[model samples]
Target: MTTDGFTTCLWFDGQAEEAAHYYVSVFKNSSVGRVSHYTEGAMQPAGTVLTVEFTANGHKFVALNGGPQFKFTEAISFQVFCDNQEEIDYYWTKLTEGGGEPGPCGWLKDRFGVSWQIIPERLDEMISDPDTAKSSRAMQAMLKMHKLDIAALEKAYAGE
Candidate 1:
């Protein structure tokens, strides 16, 4: 881990480039940085994609062609902090397209089987409100949501 920056490497079954393209298209401030192909002497077949570098909403990531031996799980996910409902909706819709599945509490699995958390920035503050009752209401609201509703959370926090 260098102080220069950090990258989250994603393992794919020979879909590094495809996944990179998909991610770049979905994220607001994202793009593919590099695409490296394997050559002779590599574990994968020659001329196959080896690794890809990309940015999803400014987060550096490396997608590797590590074969299908491993898979993405719910244990890890990229959490996107959004300012409002529109941002949340955009992310949720784009990320859950194709074969993606929706999960409780603003979690969803993309077509590539990558888990994503489309979270509202204010949700944390509301859930940790100084008033315990307000915080409890916020928590209850959040637990019942698939795609977070910021207004609903605010209303609940206000005991309405």
Candidate 2:
């Protein structure tokens, strides 16, 4: 067996190549890698795309054209930690474009139905603070917003 580290595999219904390219375009340190095609006696057409290996934000992934038997659900989501509101907004906008739906509390489903959580890096610190009042306020602020706002969360944490 290969001793490779964990690589996430995303199941797609004949959209493996498209998803791989889209993910690579959205991320900074990303690139599309090797692509595998179906062979004779395979479940799909012999020349059809089987899997597309890619690296998005330095994370390895494989987009598989595994048919419509499987679909992505909110049960599994990718969390993008941002240093500031600009980063959060950028990711939120890009991920929510082209038929993507925005959910509550920084959660959104991309065009391909993949869920993502764009959150501020400081959110954990604010929510986990020893002061219950501050943490509670921060949590309240977060609950009301779709895309996370760092400034608002800070203000709430400070009781301002």
Candidate 3:
């Protein structure tokens, strides 16, 4: 509760603690914060974890151990913007471990069904280039990618 801002709350089926641990381990400058348990709830038993506050690269989040009444979709996601391919590869590999699935344009769904966008900062530089032709080529290249190859995007922007 040190930092003051909006915290994103994630719903999970009794895996909030585990997810918090996993996420803090993946992102830099992250850690788990306060943990609260329920006293009497229809979903989970008393004494079970109700909410866990955590952080990822300075962004705050709260995970709730809600029941299976809800499920995660692609409507919302946490984006990890990397400056280079190495950082991008590190996040991509770690988040996709276990039962994760890869999606096009640097998108991936983790084991917990949470969507993540592992994008390189250069992607924007290329896609937003002043030259319309170069930007269009970069967009086309990005549309065909999974993990997002920064080198390929640069190549497309250069029209080579």
Task: Arrange candidates by lDDT, descending.
Answer: 2, 3, 1
**Tens-place lDDT digits, model 1, residues 32-80:** 8878889998889898999998988888889999998999999999899
Q: Rank the candidates by TM-score, best first.
A: 2, 3, 1
Candidate 3 residue-wise lDDT, 93-113, digit = tens? 999998999998999999999
Looking at model 2, the pairs that clash are none
Backbone clash count, each prediction separately = 0, 0, 0
As for TM-score, the candidate ahead, 1 or 2, is 2
Per-residue lDDT value at 91 in model 2? 95
Compared with the true structure, model 2 gives a TM-score of: 0.97
Task: Report the poorest 10 consecutive residues by lDDT, candidate 3.
Answer: 38-47
- Whole-model Cα lDDT of every candidate shown, in order: 0.91, 0.94, 0.92
Query: Candidate 3 regions off by >4 Å?
Result: none
Winning candidate number (TM-score): 2
